[model samples]
Target: MATESAAPSPFEDQVLAHLRNAEAAYHAEQRERARELDELEATRAALAESQTHARLLTAELDAQRWNAERERQRVECLKQAMREIHGALFHGDVYTLILRACLTISGATRGIYVTCTRPDGPLRVRAHIDIPAIQGAAPPPMVAQLCRDVLAKNDTIVCSEADTAARLSGDEPQGLRFRNCVAAPVVLLANLDGVVLAADKMDGEFDDRDIEALLSVGDQATVAVRNRHLERELQTAYVHTVTMLADAVEAKDPYTHGHCEMASRYARLVASRLGLSEHDQALVCYSALLHDVGKIGVSDGVLNKPGPLLPEEVELMRAHVRVGYDLLNHVPALRDVADVVLRHHEHYDGGGYPDGMRGEDIPMPARIVSVADAYCAMITRRSYKDAYPEAAARAELRRCAGTQFDPVVVDAFLAILDTPEALDGDSDDFAECGLLPGFEAMRAQASPV
Candidate 1:
């Protein structure tokens, strides 16, 4: 047994050596794999960090772009406001011009021009888009009150989404109806007259950007309102001057007094019934009152001819429309009205005057005035024609519908006349119906003779 054991010692030693080598190789491979795993983990960590940094840089860039766009919008809004202020201060009919500008700039679905009755009285909506729901209808009480409050405080009130929701939850009336609003006091120095409130943003609530935009607009509006007030005062004085000039023109012809005055009153009435916008109604009133202004250019002999004129005289009489238009074109205040005056004689059938425009091609304001002028001429006393009774006037208006006058305008005029009170013997009948101011009184003041 001892001899057999001694013979296998070398073999055993060799096997032990091989076993140690295999274990060493296994341990070396394990260490290499561990090193590779550590390297992979480091790579993964670096990759994650790079992605995070990239995401951060991308977010920063997007933020900068958003801020730049917002700044550009603010700058553009400021420029527009400056332009509007310039227009308001320089232009005639600044009130109407400003209203139109506000509508365009604010993106309002509708806007109303309002004036306070007194320093502290409630705001009365004067002009709007001419929707039947708004015309002559009382504004919501809270809106009136809010306007008063803003005027009193001289502070701008911006109703954002949260504020709107909160206000709606309260007893306040108007804010609940409007989804969003921005109101700024229309103050001139220390005098607080009223506030221009823009309501109902089509997108959502009024944000800071919207409030800033409105404030910019308010700055322009303040200037416009002050300018308009001054203009109205000046125009009132000019109206007196024009009245005298018109009276002198009428002095050469007695029958012209009732014709011009009654026609003006009737024109205003028809304008109201036809749903002409407040701006158009004012323009029509001005144009109708001055419709015979062209007659001022006519010689006394032709103007007071008292009977049928010669062909040349009739031709000269027909030139008055253009003459009136030209005269008013020089006066910036009456430029828009002058256009109506020039087209007042245009017929619905395209047979009537300077341009001979037909159907809807004729300006609606002119179409309204045409019916009013004809109706007043038919109803009022004339030198060569007997004044027709109201019934005869109605019949004549119906006869000329869609031919000499727009059928729709004729219908509106007839509807206004259908109320017997509107056609009563009193010359102020239309005024009593609240469609216009006192016709007889204005006629008395404005008549040439």
Candidate 2:
């Protein structure tokens, strides 16, 4: 132990050093290989991440394309709907076209077109899709609130789940548990006219595109409504003009100043008794008032003549119907009334008239007017005749029911005479005239027939 365990010789020491160098070199190489392996593993990980990122980008781009295509299709559908609205005949038809476009763009399950002159009052459900709306009944609380809110804000509003749940008022209509809503308000004549609102989007909550679509459709619908309003105004003006013309003819003849006015009441009463529709009733009444308007075109000599006229003079007198027809034929609202005016002189037996139309050949409105006019003329004092007694007028009306007048019209007129108002013509109740019919009287239909 004491002798330093034998000091190695130089050659042996050199050999040991060489062996130690080799072992050291081997360990260093192993460390280098470990470092290389770590770098390879890191590179593989980076490559995987890049591939994943690429896939994500590709997927996002694809999704965007799909959405773009959907939007394109939606816009096209809306465009087509807009074109269809141009052909809409009624306000109801216009509303329907707007709703269909909304459904197409928003994926809504149901749609409604509501209007109210006041925001606080009950809303009128003019048109609907898939909702059994009772038109005049109370609207669903949710829908009512949506419309009210839209009106108050004067802007479009979108109600998602939470909003619908909180803002919902009383019991909604069955199956009206809306998860989402979109309300587009339409302003007209400087007032809040109404709202076009949709509910229950099927796919998801309403987004920007849905709101935009609704606004576009609302604007289109507003145009249609405004057009209808203008048409109504024009129609009213035309009717007023007709009234003036009737008055002018009456002014020319002292005895006929109130003749046309009285005859109209009789015609309307007869129409009502016969169960004619409001439009038909209005037709008969208007025809009666304007039946003699064409006489304005006749020479004053013929109109003031106290005796029977020659053949040529009579021909001139019969031309009054043609004149009246020409005047009204150009106005679309009065076209139907014109038919009555032109044919009112036709006899029930085909013996009297310029057209020789008989029996059912004459329009029913004209038939009614013929009976009312004859009776009224019989009872009134004319330039050429004396006023007939009430009994005599009644007898005369009965005498010509089948030959000169529509028998059914004569019977209906006599039956409703429980009071003397039919002959008095004193009441100013022009209530049944429907000067601006609710799509019935003075209807301004623009759709292509």
Candidate 3:
């Protein structure tokens, strides 16, 4: 066997070695290619994961931005509502201001405000805003009831199509229909003052955000209403004080017992007949009541004397107008009426003392007070002169219309007395006041041809 194993070919052995080396190199190349492919796959997978993460972050960022925008808008609406409420408080038109502010904040088409003096009292409609048509129409029963529920609960109610049918199943509005609504209670502590309602959203359906906004407005409205009540109380106290002062002045003279009251009544009537505004009418009445307030500064000797005043006494009596001006001008609240008091004696024909303002130069309130004072004085039984008869007083007023009184004011005063029932009750008092029957005929007789 050793002999037979003779000499294997060296070439064959080398070829075999070469073949083995080539096979090994091919396997190594295949392994390298597989590794490269595996690396490429891993890189692609990592890149895909990064892209997905970036997309997720972008979506989250957009959501955050949207939320921030909504929050900003909500804050802006609240700020605007606060500003409007402050303006309303200052202007003393709380109902209108609150309703308008609520409408702006909620973007509602219509709004209604209601209040009650007592908890069990009937509701009073304070203000309303309806588009296009309808002025101050009463709220629907359902809406009113919903407002009541809000008050009872001391919270806000939001009604959409989802709940409106269930909440107001059997009720319907009279003129308009609503698809969405919101109501809030205006409360201070445990006391429910009123309710505020908003309906028919302009943008979309009302939601919880709207409720929150309205509740905020409701709180401000409650504050405004409270302030209004306080202001009214203060005004009443001030008026009472002023009236007492006027009474004291009138008490100094026995003949002028009812002079201030009569003059104020007559001035108010004339102002109403002249179609003056409510504020102006009040001004005229108050000024007439206080027109003789300066008499306090005059000497009692001249004021209470039963005889005609001497020239010097008359001069002293005339000085009262200036004194009253000085006294009232110091009070900020009464300063506006002070000018009217000072000019009340000024004649339309430029013959009166103090200013001699002629015709329209006189303030309308002063002119009105002057006419009322003159008529009251003429009809009053004074220490120096008997009271003029009704007819005689009317004739005298007509005779001196342009000379001592404003003709326009005279006409208006006469017209006020011309009503059928103007002198209906208490013939004695009417006669004493010189408000005679047949005033229309008297005015006709006094009219220039």
Candidate 4:
């Protein structure tokens, strides 16, 4: 009966079913835990890879920043050097200044400036710095020859070693020593003018970096040198043009050869005696030279008249000053000259021609030129009359000083005439007319008026 009852207990059967269900739930929970563990492992691997990628990105960013910074520094240095070069060029001889600047910029052990005599000729040293006393006194012939070759070819040469051994192997001069050298031609357009040589890099042997720096310096030097050369040429040309213009005006009057320039010199001398500033002296000189340029517009008969001018002719002659002023007033380079030309005939005591400018109303340059021109005319032999003696000319200037001539300018002229050299008329003529040679020829081919 107990065995039968054990098979038939509902509550016990329920308990067994509950235990089996619990075991199944436990197995399911264990499976879920294993899946969660696998997911966690995968997440850790992804995080590690992401961190590595972030590190790599940060390293790449740092490298880019470093490169950018270096480039900025290099550009700034080049700009500074260029500015210095520009300043030096304006202040002094361009070649000398550039040579000094290059030495300072590159910090080379030594530097040399060599210019060729001709396009293909040998090179001669113009300037140099930082060498043995003996070497400086006499540069090696091989170095000079090499400079010529480089300039002729318009090529650059960089040598890492400049010792006697290296030089001897190549047939260069002996007893020479240099660790590095760079040579470049001063080329403008396709023509080579000279060469620049730098030796012994202070930091290390010549490399691309060193070469690039030298090249930059060389380029600036070349430009500055060329500009200075051009400026000198322009100054020469300007002087020539001024002389020619004066001559052309003088040629209109048969009795007035070289008179304009002579009068200008006299005017400058007078102004100098007055303790005038250099600028004012120059103005006086320029004005005197151009005082009669308006006569170019006058008729030949009137300009070269051998007799007294008629009242009408005198009026026509007076118009020339205004005409000259008009002709030159619009030109920026000649405005000052035009102003003096207009007022030079004005009287100092309020009675004058054109605008009737009086006293200080007339420019100082005009006043000064008026006194010089009158003095020169008094002492100069004319077709109408012989020249006056020094005493008579001095008396005439003094007589007209307060009325016709500027008082200060007349005083200066008197002082200039007091010198022993002004006693002889011929001496006065020479003093007034001595101009730089070839002035006319130079003027004929000048660029413009």
Which candidate gets the maximum lDDT versus the true structure?
2
In model 3, the clashing pairs are none
Estimate the overall C-alpha local distance difference test score of candidate 1. 0.67
| TM-score-based ranking | 3, 2, 4, 1
Error of 4 at 20 (Å): 62
Q: Give the TM-score of candidate 1.
A: 0.49
- Candidate 1, residues 100-153, lDDT tens digits: the string is 444445555555555564547756665554322243455555556666667667
Each model's lDDT = 0.67, 0.78, 0.73, 0.68
Q: Using TM-score as the measure, name the better of candidate 2 and candidate 4.
A: 2
User: What are the TM-scores, per candidate, against the unseen true structure?
Assistant: 0.49, 0.66, 0.67, 0.59
Decide which is better by TM-score, 1 or 2.
2
For 280-315, candidate 4 gives per-residue lDDT tens digits of: 666677777778878878998887788889999999
Q: Candidate 4, after superposition: displacement of residue 13 in Å?
A: 69
**Order of quality (lDDT):** 2, 3, 4, 1
| Segments in model 3 whose C-alpha atoms lie over 4 Å from true places | 1-84, 89-92, 116-124, 130-144, 160-177, 187-192, 219-226, 269-279, 298-301, 355-361, 419-449
* Backbone clash count, each prediction separately: 1, 0, 0, 0
lDDT of 3 by residue, 145-173 (tens): 77677766767888776566666556455
- What are the runs in model 4 whose C-alpha is more than 4 Å off? 1-97, 107-119, 122-184, 197-211, 221-241, 270-282, 330-332, 416-449
Residue 287 lDDT, candidate 1, scale 0-100? 73
On the 0 to 100 scale, the lDDT of residue 222 in model 3 is: 61
